[model samples]
Target chain A: MSENLIPLEQLQKTCLYDSHVALGAKMSPFAGFMMPIQYDSITVEHNAVRQKVGMFDVSHMGEIFVKGPEAEAFINHIFTNDIRGYEPGKVLYGMMCYPDGGTVDDLLVYREYLANHFLLVVNAANIDKDFDWIQEHAKGFDCKLDNASPRIGQIALQGPEAEKTIIEVLGYKEAADLGFYTFCDVEYNGERLILSRTGYTGEDGFELYTTNENIVEIWDKFLKAGVQPCGLGCRDTLRFEAGLPLYGDELSPEISPVMAGLGMFCKYEKDFIGKETLLDQKAGNLEKKLVGIEIEDKAIPRAGYPVETPEGEEVGVVTTGYHSISLDKSICFALVKKEYSALDTPLCIRIRKKVFPGKVVKKRFYQTNYKK
Target chain B: MSKILDELKYSESHEWVKVEGNIAYVGVTDFAQKEMGDITYVDMPEEGDDVLAGEEFGALESVKASSELISPVSGTVVLVNAELEDAPEKVNEDAYGAWIIKVEMSMPSELDKLMDAAAYKKMIGE
Candidate 1:
């Protein structure tokens, strides 16, 4: 069920590990954790999140807390998004880039507690590296940094019926009032729970974060409520269909936000790291650009497959490709040269000695149903 | 547990062979089809092509990944399953029924080395 064959003892398990096992989930290593890839089938799970509702054990995601008088300034210095005037309950999505304009990580910043406090949710695999990187840049800041990932657990209840499920099953009354990308702190069993109308699946949903002790019970209630148990496999498909970027695939150290067409999220008026480089990129100084392509045939284009022009000259490689479950067509994200990045541009993807024709299209392959 | 047919012979690479006279019908076993979810495409060798035993003759593309389809018995391809060219999901529906190719065996004696239904089941830990 796993690829790398890491020592079983070394793989970390989530709070709902036993529950996943008992449900006969196909477990695989993901971000150093024994994560469920699927419970029944990838097709079934992917359709559930797109058509109905599904829940993901997103506990492996990193949660870092920043506090102190210098919190806002320090975060603004490192973050691409300007959070200086952010309201306490506001949430912002952006990236932390290196000085050379390479991506460090894309993250979400949530301000909920006080004027000087914020929660940074990051990818699980980069927890240690991100913490150290943030700490290194935080040498002169007076803010206190806490890597609270090990103590926190999260669940993303997603679909059109998310609010109803959260109300009827989990009984979180605040879900009905929360706006997209916004969260409210709720007290459950004397423990603070952060419930937000945020999701990666491009659906109307809510993400709840709480202590590890509270997560298992919350998961049980969802399980008993018959919420479809989704895994990382479908989570990927749903997010891909939504045009949401995955860190490792879409954004990496070499693939900057501007290159990935995410420059809109980067506020350039501030003095953040990599601001100058990104600004230069925005002014037509970029080379390879990420674009969406639709394959004209049944051949599936996969990552690392060379994308070529009509003359067979290699342009770039596929970053992520799939037979989109919702659209019922073959589409992929590729980083091709600027000349071939425009819509309706013709490109070819070579899969195992066979070159398939494709055309560039909008990145958002499926219409999202996010509740405003 | 995966299904096993008494009339079919199996290879360790998870392919099944149904012999009819000198022709061997080749397809992926139930275990292989189930493990590879949602077959999307099937790359097959053209008719009259020589297929070597234990060599990759084609590929099975699924939603998750593309897996190589190894030939269990070496022979010249008699016919390619044209139906799978557009309807690859037939394998997911019925692995044994969805024969990928029919080969006129160059070495029909090679069938003696393959495992029957009982031995194949034991080998797959069914």
Candidate 2:
């Protein structure tokens, strides 16, 4: 009964609202937008992406453009990842952080076709906040920042057969040759679209960004070609199964990328926001760390559930958990005390009134099938 | 539209109860299963555990969120559908057919306070 009490009138609808309604999708308010939670079933859509091909309406994700002579310097100052040596068509996954190392948002930085032109794809909920934060920091830099979230629409074609679907359905044959973490700008039917070989799902996939009208055309084309239309429900499940971190769940203002075990994305050689704190944590001064907890019981360990020791001492709290659809096991990510984060460390998760015994395991319950 | 049995009693919280003599069977309504999307797990109370009217006895988990299973009548749990422990999707398949618990009703009079199928249909804006 504890649902969001926000009025439906206040929510914004995407350009594909009519399409989703025509497909009999279940619409729900998410991140200030009325998004499709499911069209058929979460399991069915999830399996489609895992086994064959599926497309998701990801237009709610924010797209910010940074361009100028100081663009790379400005991005490197805010982003944790090193972007100095990235080619024009490269994409890097990293996070923007506060001075204390807490994450502002985890994003994908796409180096555009034009020199010194970079595109930052951020979470839907953090669009406005991230834009304001970036604008505030750009005062010192000479980069021109543009918040293009409302002007663009995105679709993710994901699965083992994603490349084939893109070629056969959208007629974008060049996508078949794109390398991992690379992108290209193509003009189709007089419309410019950015196709990137990067996805949140651990599958061989591509994300297409274009104008709203072109997105609608592409969506219709995919639907006609029999590609499954996925929703936010399976999107979370797919990313979770692949051990990818969700912004509000696994990464947050209180949780650092280092604490979340994403230290590799943070290059210590560059001095970015939260560099000092992250460097100190890398030297083994952190208190809590994220770890995977797998429960033997069928009862799921949900978010905010207390993680405890066998004798009832509270150790941490679950950030995200589920009875994994693919793995068929109750698994979760918890930010536990650093000492208890080691593999094989026994832990307990309190589900409702019962405390189920579990053990610390690798976060990846399902092995990724990303086409390297 | 979800199926609503005319002979069954329903709660505002979407629980359905079928009373027979002193025993009553409880399960989530079809409307609830549809609203919940897919049923991943059902947390059921142990046999012989006491439950009061309108109190939460267990929960039903879906992919998105968990919904508390509120008791429609006061009773002691006599049996639980153990099959749901492994095949929770059965509820999504047939909500009424997949009864969650059988209770030995301590007060069968509580059934009179619940709505009938007609009232439940109207309450859900059908």
Per residue, candidate 1 scores C-alpha lDDT tens digits across A218-250 of 899988988999999889888988898998889
Task: Report chain A TM-scores, every model.
Answer: 0.98, 0.98
DockQ of 1: 0.61
- DockQ per candidate, 2 decimals: 0.61, 0.75
TM-score of each prediction: 0.96, 0.97
Best by DockQ: 2
The sequence of per-residue lDDT tens digits that candidate 2 reaches over residues A180-247 is 89999998679889999999888889999999899999999999999999999999999998899998
- Once superposed on the true structure, which residue ranges of model 2 sit more than 4 Å away at CA? A1-7
Give, for candidate 2 chain A, the lowest lDDT window spanning 10 residues: A1-10
Instruction: Indicate the residue-level lDDT of B108 in model 1.
Output: 95
Best candidate, TM-score: 2
Q: Give the TM-score of candidate 1.
A: 0.96
- Number of the top candidate by lDDT? 2
